[model samples]
Target: MGLIVASGLCLALWVVLWCFHIAARDAAMISFSLFLVAAAVRTVGEQVRQSNSREG
Candidate 1:
């Protein structure tokens, strides 16, 4: 459940950055990319984990 919420939060962050063009401090700009990567990795990892769990 927490992971699901985090995915939503990443989407909102992206909307703000790309759609609304929110100004973030120079260092914070890295956060947007990190969020995307984290979401993707988390989703892929979860899928792989679940598949492996079900295989046995």
Candidate 2:
């Protein structure tokens, strides 16, 4: 769920930047970076969740 939201937000940001006439390359790069961050966060969250479950 959080991952979905993060991805959506990144996509929205890209769209908004495009609407404002930002360069496509720049906007894509920014959004791609955001998506990578989101993916990393999601991976960390999953690892934490798994560790907690094991400890519990």
Candidate 3:
């Protein structure tokens, strides 16, 4: 589930960047790395929220 959402977000970002031709090779690599980290954070955050909700 998390993988699906994360991949979708990554794909969307790449698509948008390519469409606008704004991201170069180097920028794309950096952007993808940043997006990956952000997605991981998002996944962790969602799990934390769910755990707290269940505990409460």
Candidate 4:
């Protein structure tokens, strides 16, 4: 849920930057970094959930 929200915000930022023709490269880099972080968190969460389910 949190990841979804963060991703939305990043998308909005990217759009705003694109519309204004501002720091396009920086915006893209930030968005990419956020995506990577979200993916990592999601992967870790899934692994933890699976491990817990197996233990129980």
Instruction: Identify the superior model by TM-score, candidate 3 or candidate 4.
Output: 4
Deviation from truth (RMSD, Å), model 1: 19.4
TM-score of every candidate relative to the true structure: 0.48, 0.59, 0.54, 0.60
The C-alpha lDDT values of all candidates are 0.85, 0.94, 0.93, 0.94
Q: Supply candidate 4's per-residue lDDT for 39.
A: 100
- By the TM-score metric, which is better: model 2 or model 3? 2
> Model 3: how far is 48 from its true place, Å?
0.2
> For residues 1-56, what per-residue lDDT tens digits would candidate 4 score against the true structure?
99999999999999997877767777998999999999999999999999999999
In model 4, what is the error at residue 24, expressed in angstroms? 0.5
lDDT score, candidate 1: 0.85
| Model 2 stretches with alpha carbons more than 4 Å out | 1-22
Candidate with better lDDT, 2 vs 3: 2
Candidate number achieving the greatest TM-score relative to the actual structure: 4
Instruction: List the lowest-lDDT window of 10 residues for candidate 3.
Output: 17-26
Better model by TM-score: candidate 2 vs candidate 4: 4
Q: What's the CA RMSD of model 4 in angstroms?
A: 17.5
